[model samples]
Target: MQREDNFTFLTEEPIPKVIGTMAVPTIISMLISNLYNIVDTYFVGQIDTQATAAVGIVFSLMFFIQAFSFFFGNGSGNYISRQLGARNRESAEQMASTALGYTLIFSIVLVVLGLLFLDEISVILGSTPTILPYTRQYLGFSLLGTPFLMCTLCMNNQMRFQGYARYSMYGIIVGALLNCMLDPLFIFGLDMGIRGAAIATVIGQIVGFAVMFRMSLHKDIIHYTPRNFSHRWLFVKEIIAGGTPSISRQGLASIATIALNVSASQFGDAAIAAMSIVNRIVMFIFSVIIGLGQGYQPMCGFSYGARHYERVKAGFWFCVKVGTAFLLFWSVVLFAFSDRAIGLFRNDVDVISIGIPALRYQLLSFPFWSFMIMANMMMQTCRKTLQANILAASRQGLFFIPLILVLPHCFGLLGVEICQACSDFVSLLVTIPIVFSAFREMHV
Candidate 1:
């Protein structure tokens, strides 16, 4: 579609049609992006159980990188969407450029600080004596690609919010496919071990960033350049308000993972490895619902901005119903074969036993995500920062953090296993009324 028609479709097209067209590619893109890690884990799993634990341990730091990426990406993407919806193209481009520019600078700074204190950071991330060496090796290469990873995230969000999800998918898929191919080559073909996996990841990220950056140059998309960058107080406030939920979501996730690793460490490497595998598996599933929610989000922003509140309401409910049904079905499948699923990454008997039961507990609360994730996105897209931030933080930190901290200490490994499931159930109760009232207030 042409640039003008594409932007127009966000508000003018039938809501379901818009969502389906936009969401599928976005979903694919998300799954592919995640595949990079999954592929790494799969290959790393072959080495030994401890290597798998190392991968899992280092994931917390990676989440820290992702947190900042989402912060800038969503910060700028949300503002750009609203501006475009309001027919203010100049402001949209300016916000896009500013978010990317700021993200790049911050990421570079993080890389320097992170590399300087790599050993300390690894220990703090819950790496034990055995897993420490592999963790540092993997994290070192991953850090090299931090700037590009952040850039990829920022542009990916910007494209999706601009109603150009296909372009976003192309950029992401190109790099993900590259990573998949490079994984074996680097890890085994070149006999580099876990360090090879990290190198493949960095190379994939750089390629993805290049593709995404090139795509943004298209006239249909928002062009991000220094010339359009604005660091004004007004823009800063908007970015913070708009992106707070994303920051909360990704940031708290990092914290939750750190706590989970710390709590799991008390048991053994098996527990840490099991939880890591389970977490990745859960994220892969959750990313689908999130992608669908991403599909719904542009409609949410455009409809709310253009004052077509009924469309906003319609889009919200459509996502809730569809997301709920899928979660229900997938939960059953995951529950039925939890053993096989965890074994896919690590074949250790202990990891399998711990993961199978724990994964089922996590699956029990999967349906709640249909509600939690959609509501968070709707509120975020509509610029309800306070509610969105709380909802975002609730799942990843507020709820999960406390439970993981306390539950494991009391219940032992069982506490570590069920902590996330318990948190999800509580979050559902905490989340329902906030979102319902937000929807109740929407008017045409």
Candidate 2:
């Protein structure tokens, strides 16, 4: 009876109300998570520019870890939602367990490899001589939390796709709030410096994992148990089909960060620190759109499975319109205060100068992301795998990768500042036709 209610809620609730109900908690969770990063950046910036830059350098590894977590989380979550929509509860349960099991095994391997190759990985992440020691300290401790972090994300996505986003939000909010509290205690009070920041983050991830794991045991939610774990070719294929877009999207983001750091390193530590701060700020602002798109995903998945195509289309347009308006407002406000915003993280003049224009330039293309992100999420959820993969790789991979390499060489510092904006514009152009084509097919 409870399960039937969930189906009715997803499939019959007015599109606006359904998305709003789902998006509010998701937006809050995303904001809290990004806020913790901002807070972490602020505390680290107090130490010195080098320490702040070290965190930037280590962001590549963090992105890599998140990429895999999303790979498992989105992959299984996508399948789970569709299964639930089709009233195949048994299959959804199996997928939940399998995703958790595989995520654990994969994250353990990453921990081992990351610990063994810490120095090499740090260097590969574009750590400069001045920043290498801080990078090593932070990355080493951060690696210890990889499994907990990865599994927490996996479970969070699973619960969200199950239409229990409030439970997912609770786990994330609790962890982020705890991390914010611990940051000052561990970093300044303990005098642990950057290492303290890393330790606090690890502890937060552990607590988040515990909370979400307990929540998963609730009778309403699907249970993940060892008894249901399976790696049969069929399940593997389904996970791959549903999850590859996320892997491409996040994996390329990791690679793009590495490229950006390497390119920025050519200038100096100040450049790296500046760009890093800009990335965090942008991510914080963009979290709203991501939350909206995530809210749309489960509805899209369930409706698509249940053959309610009109609801899926309505939800997509609703998200795009709302997201675009939100970004437009922020772009103008942030553009006016870019310098002040940049200065809040780091007081250095060079860092502020580089970050100000970068933030503004990116803002120019920010509104377009509403359409791009919503379209990609729609494609991914609807099992348009080929289109999803292409869009996923476009901004960061196909366009950004080459642009970062060439633009920096041609335009010097200015090129580095505007590369992401350029990539975003081109990606938007590429996405237009693909999205329209998908819409046409749905109508037919």
The model with the greatest TM-score is 2
Model 2 residue 250 lDDT? Answer: 83
RMSD, each candidate, Å? Answer: 1.1, 0.9
Model 1 ranges with Cα > 4 A deviation: 1-3
TM-score per prediction, in order, is: 0.98, 0.99
Off by over 4 Å in 2: none
Per-residue lDDT over 1-444 for candidate 1, one digit per residue giving the tens place of the 0 to 100 score: 575576678788988899999899889988998897789899999999888998988888888888888888877787878888888989888888888999999999999999999999998898989889999999998999999999898889888988888888877898889999999999999999999999999999999999999998887787767798876988889889988898798888988998898888888899999999998999898999989998888777877878888888888889889989999999999988898999999999999999998999999999889889988888888889999999999987898998988997799889988998899988999898998788778866
RMSD to native, candidate 1:
1.1
Pairs of colliding residues, candidate 2: none
The lDDT, on a scale of 0 to 1, for candidate 1 is 0.88
Candidate 1: pairs in clash: none
Q: Against the correct fold, how does model 2 do in TM-score? A: 0.99
Evaluated at residue 43, the lDDT of candidate 1 is 96
The Cα local distance difference test for each model comes to 0.88, 0.91
